[model samples]
Target: MKYYPQLTKRQAVSALEEFLAERAPALERFRQALRADGRDPDTLLDGTTQGLVPLWGWVLSGLTGPDAPACTDPATVPHEDWPSWERFTAETEAILSYESVQLLDGFISYLVRVVEDRTPTAQWQIGQHPNKRYQFRNHPVLAGADRQIFFPGPVASSAREVVRGRRAPANDEMAGYAQAVIEALSAEETRHEPPEPLVEVEDLGDHPIRGREIEVSLREDIAHEYSRQVDHMVKTLAMEDGITRVIREDREVLLVATPSWNTTQLQEWVTQALRDAGNDHS
Candidate 1:
């Protein structure tokens, strides 16, 4: 048995739709912006950009609308709250400015991570354990048994003859036949010509590199830097507030307060301390 993150395809799709629904107002604003710019309403809605339209359509098709029949499956998402595709498209387009693409990319990347986390990498099967095994005898010939005693009677005439033979050759005559076989194999090998090398292609400008490449692990580095910043902020708070230690678990930051200092008081103190530090930095 192997441990894996648990997520279903339906669950993933529903989550994405919910995300879009929550951002519906922002999407409406995007549509307004596009209309103000004198662009066609369907410019970004027709599923042209980055193949998002198909994904949107799939999500739309799967949703259970209010007028639609009730679904017993927990994974079947309700579309009562989801914005129409027209609004979603405008919102998606509005969010696609040069720098804003990173946000959309991040959302898609996170969804992929969620799916991968739920998938199993290893499989389970029933079989004998590797430590438990039984011994078996090897073939007599393979085990180096004497050829004369173990040989299956004499070879039949049809089996022994490569070229038509009047009868099976005697053991003493086999040497001449073996020599002839070797000569025939050598001649066949000599007749095969080696393949020629591929010709080099000309350097045409058909495929051009569009943008300058920078070497950096963007996602990993950003995550690491964010963690470092958060850790430093917590450490600063601990020093200023006379806290002993700070613990981090996933997205949570914890500080154990003394009996006299309640969690609410501690939270306020930390919040104020962060604000004061920000002011000082400014």
Candidate 2:
């Protein structure tokens, strides 16, 4: 699957500047109003900020609370846990997806830095006294696109359509339709995965950057730990004809699959190594 790349520090700074430019005029006007009343500029944006708990975090936790059955270890059971278990499972069955899990995790990391750098008093003041109220309610980016469609409960449009096509068979038919609807919605939920965080580092080597190869080196400590994990996973995979070599001169590790193996296999092996070392995201 194709992925989007993360912006570099310079790129991120540029994006931030653009973002501020769009919003700054109104914000500054509001700030002036606040300042007239002796409010701080820092306080203005602080109020507007979403703070430590990112919107994505709230959505994820609400969907799957720690105490929820899905979060609980299902192997160990107490009769009393069944109720919570069933509830959590039902919700999870409805909403669990690769994208959902990724978004929940990625946004938590993104929000931590955002919140730490923000000045709370400024954020509060900006939010309270903005020249125009910023209403993020129902914003598409804040919540996933499907948020409105399958809300409160899974959508039943397809099921309803199917029911209308046939002669409804009393309670049994309705129950079957309900089951079908649940399955369809669950499938749909997982169909849309969250966008992976993409990082585009400049390749310093030649050879056309073959099949997702990036010529880069990590910090010494991280590289050491990753080298160990990569070795371990490589053994577990038990595939011969592939060589894992640490190219100290290049300051990067290189995994080479002999020409006897197809490109697909080589890519998969390298991908697994990146994932195991948690450098896939890096």
- Best-matching candidate per lDDT: 2
The residue-by-residue lDDT of candidate 1 on 77-196, one tens digit each, is: 232322322122222222112212222222232222222233223111111111223111110111111110101111111122311334432333322332332233233232333332
Best by TM-score: 2
Candidate 2 lDDT tens digits, 138-228: 1111122222211112112222233244322232332243334333433324445444222112332224443323232233444565667
**TM value for model 2:** 0.20
- Model 2 residue runs over 4 Å out of place are 5-40, 47-114, 117-252, 255-257, 263-282
Q: TM-score of model 1 relative to the true fold?
A: 0.19
**Model 1: colliding residue pairs:** 5-118
Output the lDDT of residue 271, model 2.
60
> Alpha carbon lDDT of residue 28, candidate 1?
52
